[model samples]
Target: MAWDLSVDLIKATVQLEQPVGDGSRTVGTGFLISDPTPGGKPRTILVTAAHVFEKMPAMSAKIGYRVQGKDGVWRFDPTTLKIRDGDHPLWVKHPTRDVAAMEVEAPPEFVKAAIPINYLAQDDTFNRYNLGPGDEMMALGFPRGLSANPAGFPILRAGRVASYPLAPATSFPTFLMDFSVFPGNSGGPVFMAEGARRRPGSNQTQEVQFVAGLLTQQVELSGERLEIGIVTHAKFIRETLALLDKLPGATVTQAKAGKTVKGDPPMPPATPAVAISATAMAASR
Candidate 1:
């Protein structure tokens, strides 16, 4: 498989964590996406699920980043990406959606590492793909906060679109991916990358890729869990960004570094979502 999709996915995704009452922490995932319509300040927002942050007990959480050392080595650096200090929510949730975004200043190199807004599939663009049930898709995330290597890179998982009429996803705020999601996979990029495909009448194949959407939940029956992942359509993400555009700074209240925070409802999951917060689950374990 080509590495472009995996590369971009891992480069942009990070782990979000905060301490718990027992001196431990819960873990979730988040990724970097540029505001689709930037007006003045070239905004870069951290994208994740509202439920992920809502389960937190502290206003502030640390984001995990991989920084390259002068020795040409990558190191896992836990950076303090503050949200709110007290009762204020650090992220702006979509009015009726499970998604949320927040503005923040990150390392210049990291900002540059963000996935471009255009990478997301749009109305006409998504229509072109002609996706349906069983088409292959992939996601980059940390399952149970575990990465492939020591540098803290995300793990790549592949699945198919389990929802029909995959196009015009706006009508359907969410879709489904046929992948088993773990506790820490929420807020990760659920996308299809550009790749080669056979043309109908020709011996030649064409390359294509798309940011299908963001993974939100995993599908599970009350008694038996299925390996299905629910993904929020990227359209709502665009809508949320547009909503933020209306705000002066497109920001939620700044989460103070020292303040302790305490923090959902699930998306009426057609498919299951990865809702087990590492912190929340770990405490119970």
Candidate 2:
């Protein structure tokens, strides 16, 4: 089933890890979204989480990017890619969107190897495929630092959406799901369904175009009993890309010259009539 899809699709999946302040590493999964600013040049824009990028105890972590390679392909030396400027988001000085874009110098051979990302907000047809409770999902990542066996890709663990609209009612665009999310699965793509049986030569079943959500946080349980996972809705990813377009030096256009207008962090406009009022309804005693 993995062989059927082109590299462009799989290249969007990523493994994200960074060094924390205490000399430990914090890992998760994330994927790339190809929302080029007017021009079509490549940009290293990715969607993960605000908490994921923000360092624990208020210090940010060093960001790292990983790509898929052949079973025998040795991992590229870290020096092969250079992150422009300081690695911390605060240094970049853009509003904390919980997402960040980087300018990296990738090796020549790795230039054209990434998959283009997609979004549900592109059309009504795409949004209709958004996931809800009881739907199937597959968390693809290197959980527990376990590398692939003989396969070139990481392991894919199957799961389901534990809840609907992962964010609070006030935050309509965001959603969450319950999966067995682990240490390394953050920023990974949580696919709708995997390997649905198909006949040898058919239309290929639409290629599951609805990549409805992204794996973000895993609810840590106290004991051996399994609990749930959390996913950020794909819509936030779309919004992040739109915001990136507004930033300076994003594309060929000259950045507007002046101090950036700063205020509260930017967020998507609230959904209509979705407010939660504590006093509108009478208490049932």
- C-alpha TM-scores of all predictions: 0.83, 0.61
Tens-digit lDDT track for model 1 on 71-114? 98976666666677578776788998778888766677667888
- The TM-score measured for candidate 1 stands at 0.83
lDDT (Cα atoms) of all candidates against the true structure: 0.70, 0.43
- Leading candidate by TM-score: 1
After superposition, candidate 2 runs with Cα above 4 Å error: 1-10, 20-23, 56-111, 119-127, 149-152, 164-171, 193-207, 220-226, 251-285
In candidate 1, where is summed lDDT lowest over 10 consecutive residues?
A: 264-273
lDDT (10s digit) by residue, model 2, range 84-113: 225434322225333444433333333344
Please estimate how well model 1 matches the true structure, expressed as its whole-model Cα lDDT.
0.70
RMSD of 2: 12.1
